[model samples]
Structures are given as structure tokens and as C-alpha cells.
Target: MPSSASAPSRARSARPGYRAVLRAPHAGRTFGAALLGRLSYGVVPLALLLAVRDATGSYSAAGAAMALFGLASVLLSPVRAALVDRHGPRRALPPMAVLYSALLLAVAAATARPGTAPAALAALVVAAGACTPPLGPVMRTLWRRLLPDPDLLRRAYSLDGVAEELLFVSGPLLVGLLLPLVGPAGAVVAGAALLLTGALLLVASPLAAPHPRGGDREERQAGADGAAGGGRGRRAGRLGGGRALRSAVLAAAVTGLALGALDLMVVAFAEQQGRPEAVGWVLAALSVGSAVGGLGLGALDRPLPNAVRLPLFTAGLGVALAAAGLAPNLLLLGAAVALAGLFVSPALTTSYLVADEAVAPDARTRAGAWVNTAVNAGSATGGATVGLLVGHLPLPLCFALAAAPALAAVPALRTRDFGGARSRRKSDPAPDPAP
Candidate 1:
């Protein structure tokens, strides 16, 4: 039995192998999980829409079913996060995946019944949404666990951001491809199956396992010492409950507003010159730019403070949106949209990272879910506002208006001591433990 000091040295001797795994093996799992998660999100929405439309023979009904699905996800996300926090990802993910898959199949089955199709579709959508496996938040927590180096963590998040962008861009495309083959009903069934496979794979991955007790205990001790050391730790711990909820709400509102405006602008711009196809190209350009930025960030060697990075990114996004709105031609507008989108993914990734650092471990999943909900809400608000303004105001004005939330985030970027600094020494490679 070596002394405690000798034990760390001995542990250090074993680290080269672990580092190799962290650099490649762990990253592969994280990326795989992200890809599968995105694939499911990408496929499921279209499948649902197609199924609902087929069953009810109305696009409106399909849209309503989709809305219900969104509502289910928004309402249940926190609950899923809470489950992950309490029981760990492994325990929570598999069952939810199974349930979601079953509900998707139920929707497929209901579509065959003319009388019960509409109600069944709605119910199934809600059920599927409620049980939807939250791969992003869970995988993020896993990333923190498996890759403890700060630079690596940043890269991991950057990769995750890129995967997300790809998902938005590719999910619909995959759904489109599958729809013709599976005939809407088969597509929905396939999506459910795919989701089930991915979720189970994610749950079983070694990276997704619960943290070892020794690590957890060490973190608690460090937190206690840090809390005793200064006001920062005190404030960090205090940012729970209402304050955390408020911040999350504000962030979500801003996200919803910005996204909605962007969606409206895209449609309006495409319709401006009667080139309906331009909308797809413009959206693709935006996603491409975001993916490019995420890739760039993933390859970076240095990390910027979130307090600094987030505000800068937000401001950049606003400028890009304004430019996109003011562009004279479709090409120019597409370029601006792409540039604006570049900042969006990175900015969002940074915000979530900050929220992860700021909130307590117990509340982390809920915090993340709240952020997601805020984004959706902001997107809805933006769409509504842009729709109203497109007819009344100039297109440039609408773009500027859409940029408001990102602009607003600038003022809110004031640095508060979120106790992350204590455990997160500049010398240390990973994020502050768990919290």
C-alpha cells in the first residue's frame, strides 16, 4: 500500500492510456450519441406530421398534433432532466426511450382508424413528447464526466454544437427520404425503431455510466472548502431555485423571440421575389455557417470566459441578422443569414455551459430544459412578431426587430460570481465538478 501522495503519482502513471481514451474513445461516444439524438429529432417531426396529415386529411390537424408534441416536450423536459439528475442517465434513458417508441407506434396504429385517428394522434404525440429521451442534456453531463480537461470539454461541446446544427439540417432531409419509401406510416414506425435503438445504445455506453463515488465525494469536499474560502462560492450555491428559474426564463424568452423572427424573415425574403425555393437554400446556408463556427471552435486550443464569449457572440448575431435583413439580393441575404447563424450555435452552447456552471447539480437538467423551452418560446414570439411586422414595417426593420433579444442579452452579461472559479482553477483541465 503506497502513501496517498504516491497513489496519485501511481494514478498519474496510468493517465496516458486514459487520456488516449478521453481524446478519442470518449469523444466518439459523445459524438455518436449526439448524432443519433439529432437523427431521431430530425426524423420524428416529419413522420409525425405525415402520419397526422394522412390520418386526419388536414394539414391543420397535423400542425396541431405537432404543437401538442412540442408542448409535451417542453412540459416533460424538466421532468426528464430531474430523473437524470437523481438516478443518472443509464437508469432514466432506456425506459423513456421505450415509452416514446411505443407512443410513436401507437400514433401509427391510430392513423389506420378513421374515427379515432385525430384524438389518438394528439394523445400519442403528447405521450411521445412526454417520454422523449433527452439525449443532449444527458450526454452533456456525461461529457463532463468522461472528459475532465477544459480544452477537451470545450471541443466536446463544440462538436455537440456542430452535431446539433447537422441534425436540424439533415433530420428533415432524412425524413423526406424515408417518407417516400415507408409511406408515412412506415416512416413513423421506422423513426420509433430508430429512436429506440439510439437511446438504448446511448444508455449502455460506458461514458454514460454514473460517476464513481470517490469522485463525487472529492467534489463535495472541494465545494465545502471553496464555500468557506470566499463570497463567490456562497453566491454560486445561492443561484438555485427562483434566481436560476428567472435567468432560464429570460434566456428562453430571448431565444424564442430571435428564432421566430428568423423563421419569418426567411419566409418573407423567399416570397419577396417569388422564389419560394430560396427559403430552403437560405436555411441551409444558416445551418452551414453555424456548423462551420462549431467546427472552428472545436479545433481551438484556448478557451474564452463564457461571460465574455457569450455577450460578444450575441452582439455578433444581432449584427448578422440586421445585415441579412438589409441585404439587397437573395445571395447577399443568404450570406448574411449564414453569418448570423454561425454565432447562434456557439452562443447557445456557451449559454448552456454557463447555466451548467451556475446551477446546482440537482437542478441542472431542469435548468437545461428551461433553456430549451425558452428557445422554443422565443422562436414562436419571433415568428408572430415578424409576421405582423412584415406587412407593416420594412423588411430591414423586421430584421432589426428580430435582433432585439440578442441585443438585450448584452446588458444581461454582467459577471456574477457563480462559484465555478473555485473548483475550476485555470490550471485544471476540466469543468468544476458536477455542478
Candidate 2:
């Protein structure tokens, strides 16, 4: 077998494509299982929301419970990711999956019948959210291992992002399917089952196996360097210490803010046009545009360096959103939103790529998780901010305001290094793995 140091060279020489990534040994099984488990992230929220509403008989109570759940999940993600980095996925993932699954099952049982106490339900959901496994970050980190070639890794990230977008879309549909047969609580049960089964199968994949001691020369050297005291000060200190990661996190947060605000703004636009029902189609257009953009990015053989691409994507989103605000009619608004969507996945995928390249292998999970948290936190903040602004400001102005963060992020993201010393320059023939 080739050594870890030589793997990137071999991968670089191979043709890069979505198919090639899938064909990488163990990639298909690992990715498939991760997606299966990740689907629960999509499924559980709607299921739990419905169940909570049914149990409490008050939308306000249900919304409050979900808010606590989402806050706990988003805020504590890095902690969970740190644990994975500390213990290794094989050792850590299963327990989290088990606990998270059990909690969801408990939530289902409690919500199966009406009159469940809101406080008790809130506690259960909060615990469940805190236990939500960091599968997305783990899977992305594994992708780096599975595909050492930077091009392939880029495609993998794009594919992963697109798959995730589709998963969230399909999740609600899946719940809808189950509702006729099983109802809301049963949908929650089904989500729990999916999470447990997928997580177990993910760990069972060969790719999830720990790297043998001494197999990774770079990590070994990094470990040695860290142990040597003063050397640690010179290395990227922590998740946020590096410039590249900061840029990624900033871009991610801004883009997320734009998206979160856009969601509410779109609904408001539809309502203003006397076509509230058009909201779904407009949002679906955004998703479809994102999927297309992601697939287009994955198909590239020699795409622009992440540093160069990141700013452009963010700017594109900002300009598109600004245009969306000017649309005179609902159809035009949908078109403009779809245009904005085109940048969503590419920007996020590039951010992940930049973050992965910014840190050492040991810190990969935490690095990715930080970016994940920034996006979610920014989204939550944006929604709340826009909710207040929409009632007071013109809807068009609100849309333009939503575009501000993404536009502002462009300059910050324009820096030369998106992966610290590992990032490829614009003139480089292709990206190479860090030495």
C-alpha cells in the first residue's frame, strides 16, 4: 500500500470527478451512511415541531421549545466536535448517536399523546439537541482522508453540500409521507431509527477506522513539534487563530445571515403580492439554483483557488439579493432569489475547503464545526433581526439590508490565503495537499 505522504500525489494524478470521488475505496459506503444519519437533522426538526405543537396545543410553546433545542444544538456543536477530535470518531460517535437517538425516541413517546407538559418536553428536546452528533463535520473531515487530492476534495465538498441541501428538502417530504400512515410522533420515531442505524453503519465503514500509529508522517511531525514547546506558538494556534479560517468563518456567517433574512423576506414578498402560496415555489427555486451551482462546481477540473472563489461567490450572492429586492413582480423576485441561490453552496463548500486546509488533521473536525456554528448562529441572528426590521422598514429595503452582510464579507474574504500556507495561489496549476 502507498504511504499517507504519497497518497495526495497519486490522487492529484487521477482524473477528478464526482464519480471518481464516489469510486475512491470506501468513499461510497461512508458518504452514503453519513448522509443517512444526517437526514435526521432535516427530519427531526419538523417532526418535533409538529409533535410539540400537537402536545402543547400552542404554537408559541412549540416555537419556544424548538428555539431552545436549536440554540443548544448550534451553540454546543464545537464542544461535540472537539470530543470527536480528542477521542477519535470510532470511539466517540456511537455513544452520541445512541444518546441522541434515545432522546428522540423519548420525545416521540412523550408527544404521542396530547397534554404533555411543555417544561418536560422542553427539557427532553434540549437534551436531544445537545446530544446531536457532529456527523456533518466528521463526514467532511473523512472526505479529506478519503480523497487526498485537492480537486477531488473540492468536488466531494460540493457534492456533500448539494446532497445535504437535497436531504433537508426531502426530509420534510418524507415526514409528509409518514404522516398519513403514522402521524407526527411516528415520524419522530422514524427519524430516531434513521439516526441510530445510519450512525452505526457509518462507524462500521472501513474509512472510519483510526489511522495506524506512525502511518501519518505529517501528523506525527506536528505532534512532535507541538510537544517541543515554543514550536506550538508558531503553528496555527487554535480554530480561529489562522487568517484563512477567520475568512472562511466570516464569509460563512455573512452568507448565512443573507439566507436567513431572505427566507422571511421571501415570505413577506409573497404576502405583499397577494400570493402567499407562491412562497414555496420561490424558495424551491432558490434550492434548485443552489443544487445546480453545487453540481457545476463539483464538475470543474481546475477551478479557481478557494481564496479567489470565496469573495466572488459572496459578492454574487449580495448582488443577486440586491436585485431580488428590486424585482417588480413575484416571478421576477423568484428569479432573482434563484440567482442568489446559485452562490450559496459554492460559497459554503469553498469555506469548508478553506477551513480544512487551514488547520492540522487533528483539528479538522473542530475547524469545520466552527464554520458550521458561525453559519447557524448567523442565520438565527439574521432571522430575528429581519423579523424586527420587516415590520418597520420597506420590504425592498429589508431585502437590500439583508444583502449588506454578504457584500461586506467580500472584501474581508478577498485576502490571499484561504488555507494559510497550504492554500494554492491563483497561478498554481492545481491545489496540492499541505506538506
Candidate 3:
């Protein structure tokens, strides 16, 4: 008698453990694509600036284009994320990806043309960034879908944060490595290719498939049972109008400010020491520490709720960064930066979890988008401030300025009212029990 062919073989071939999440059906393709997509973003700003500078012979023009790119991405993120929440990836990703990649080509072409109009280059930069696949927000939503168990879900978020740091660390390195061999235009061309490839792979993932508008069966059932899903009026005031998300986004914003300060301090230190080449390794050390801390946090069985832990994490990060500025020499400064890096991703991860908790299931993608925008905005602001201050202030004082926002956020985070939406549902009349 012929038996069903694939079931026994599939069961026998299954993998296990935390890494097994990647081995889950289509997980590798989805995760890899998201990772590469983020990495390309990392490469673009620096590479595009150099490319534009080479063609135009104007650092100011290059800076203007890069700034426009950032502005567009931050401003447009929520709108794109809302589309993802409403239409899902199949309906969303391909078109945005194609448009974004095509604009990158335009930007690349503009950068290669010696006499291209400055305003034209600026327009291309902004338009390209406006539709960057909404990849980060969509990936966060997918983690929730793939991991039903609460513990596993938290772990997945931690891992996701770690992945983000890897993109930061690797993106610049790729550009640096390729620039010497390929020239600025060629490096940009490579980045555009990577973005398109990752976008296609992401769209092909099984998780990219659409879910019903509200969510799956259990979500609907929860709503029917007077959960926050059904008690929309009660949840309306808190998570209802999206006030709770502000705290989470603020926390992320401050973290970004601190990170940007650290970045400038590292560069200044390297320049002072006459070892500009060493800048890469110093930054790499910081990234490694973040990855290590995030991995340890993600693998743990026990976890702290975001509200209880977020303030403490932010405070710890602030203290460490302040102390880093006081280090006696370059060697000690690198050590201090690496030590401070330990708290970076954990704080962001906690904030993300907090943000996710405050929003309804249907609103999470857009919520994530808002938080991400706050992060980039703060970073850009801080970096610009550093550029102005690095020549005027003492180096240690500059670092202290970065640390202040994070420390200030500690009190802000504690006072912010989150989880009110869920708690509000407790007083509602009980629905009939499920059969």
C-alpha cells in the first residue's frame, strides 16, 4: 500500500532550538532578505554622499542630498507602514520595492552624471527613500505571527534588535571595502542591487502572505469575548487614540541621540590620534558588544516587562556613556564604548516591546513605523548638533550632552501611562465561555 510521502520525511528533518526559528519554513529567506534590506540602507547614505561629491565636487551638495534622503524616509515611514497593516506584503512590498529600487538607480545615474542638476539629485534621493519597503515594521509583525508563545516572541524581538545592529556595523564596512575597488558609482550600483535582491526575497517568503483584516481566529474570538479588541470604547482613550505610543517612541529617540553622540566622539578621537583608519575597528567593537548583550537577553527564559525594566535600562545606558567620555586615553575610551554598547540594543528592544503592547494588533505596523521614525530623527538631530559642537566644546563635554537625553528619558518613561488599554478591559462584562 502506498503511504503519504512527505509527512514522515519532513518530521524527521525538522530542526530545534532558538536558531530553529530561522529554520522554520521560509524563515531563512524572509530573515535574510530583511537583513540585507536593512544593510543596503546602511550603505546608501555614506555611499551616496561620496558618489554625489565625486561627480559634483561639492561636499555641500552631497550633504544636502543625503539629508533629503533621511528626511523623506522618516516622514514617509508611517504612511507606508499603514499600507502594510491594511493590505499586507503581497499587496504592498513589490510595488514599493520596485519604486524604491528604481529611484536608487536614478540617484545613482544622477550621481554619475557630472552636470546633473543639484535639485534633481535631491528630488531623486528623497523619492527613493520614501518607499524603502517598510521592511523593519513588517518584519516585526511577522515575528509575532511566527512565534505564538509569549517567551519565544520576546526572544524573537531581541534577536531582531541584534540583527539591526549587525546591519549598522556591516553596511558601512561593505561600502568602504567596495569603494576602493569599484569607485563611488559602482559602490552605489552594488547597494541598489542588494536592495532589489532583498526585496524580492522578502516578497517571496511565506510569512509575506496576507492575513484577514483584523487578524486570525483567536484574535476575532478575543474581540468577541470583550477583550480590548471588542471594548474599543474603553481602550479608546489610552491606546485608543495612540497616546501610549509616545513614551515608547520617546525612549527610542533618546537612545538614538546617545548613539549618535557616541559615533561622533569615536570619529573625533580617531582624528585626534592620527589614526583615522582605526575608526572602523573602534565602531566594530561597539557593535560586537551590543550583539552579545542582545543575544544573551534573547536566549533567556525569564524576562522583565518593558515598563518595569525600561527606565532602569535607559538610566544604565546613560551612566555608561557619560563615563565613557571620562576615559583617560584612546585605548580606555574604546573599552568604555564597548562596555556602554551593552545596554544599547536591550533598551531599544524593551522600548519596542512596550510600543507593541500599547497598540492594537491591527495598528502595530504603523506604530512600529512611528517609533522607527523617532529613532532616525533623534539620531540625525544629534549628529548635526555634534558637527556644530565638536570644534567648540571639550570632547568629554560633548559626550556628556549625548548622555543627558537618555538620563532624562528615564523619568519620562516611568511617568508615561502605557498598558492602560489592556487594563481598561478588565471591568467589562464577561462574555459567554467558549464550548
Q: Candidate 3, TM-score vs. the true structure? A: 0.87
For candidate 3, the per-residue lDDT at 402 reads 85
Instruction: Please report, in order, the local distance difference test score of every candidate based on alpha carbons.
Output: 0.70, 0.86, 0.76
Give lDDT tens digits, candidate 2, residues 1-435: 559888889877676678888999999999999999999988999999999999999999999999999999999999999888777788899999999999999999999999999999999999999999999999998998888778788899999999999999999999999998998999999999999888999999988887777434445346334423323343432443367889889988998898899999999999989999999999999999999999999988778878799999999999999889999999999899889999999999989988887666667898899999999988998899999999799998998899999998888888755563343221112335699
When 1 and 3 are scored with TM-score, the better candidate is 3
> Could you give the candidate ranking by lDDT, starting with the highest?
2, 3, 1
In the predicted model 3, the residue pairs found to clash are 236-240
Cα lDDT tens digits for candidate 3, 157-179:
88889988888767888999999
lDDT of 1: 0.70
Query: Which candidate gets the maximum TM-score versus the true structure?
Result: 2
Kindly report the root-mean-square deviation of model 3 from the true structure over all alpha carbons: 6.4
What TM-score, over all chains together, does every model reach? 0.85, 0.91, 0.87
- Against the hidden true structure, what lDDT does model 2 obtain? 0.86
Q: Mind giving the per-residue lDDT tens digits that candidate 1 earns over 1-435?
A: 559769988775654332343466656765575577558887888888987898889999999999889878876787788777666677888888888898888888887555555776798788888888887777776676666666666777677767776876677788788776777777788788877887887877877765567443444444444444434444322324333345445654665577678877888888987898889888888888888887676665455766577667778888888778888889998899889878877777776666665555444565666677677767766776787889888888888888877787767764553314533431122345685
Clashes of each: 12, 0, 1
Cα error of candidate 1 at position 274, Å: 1.5
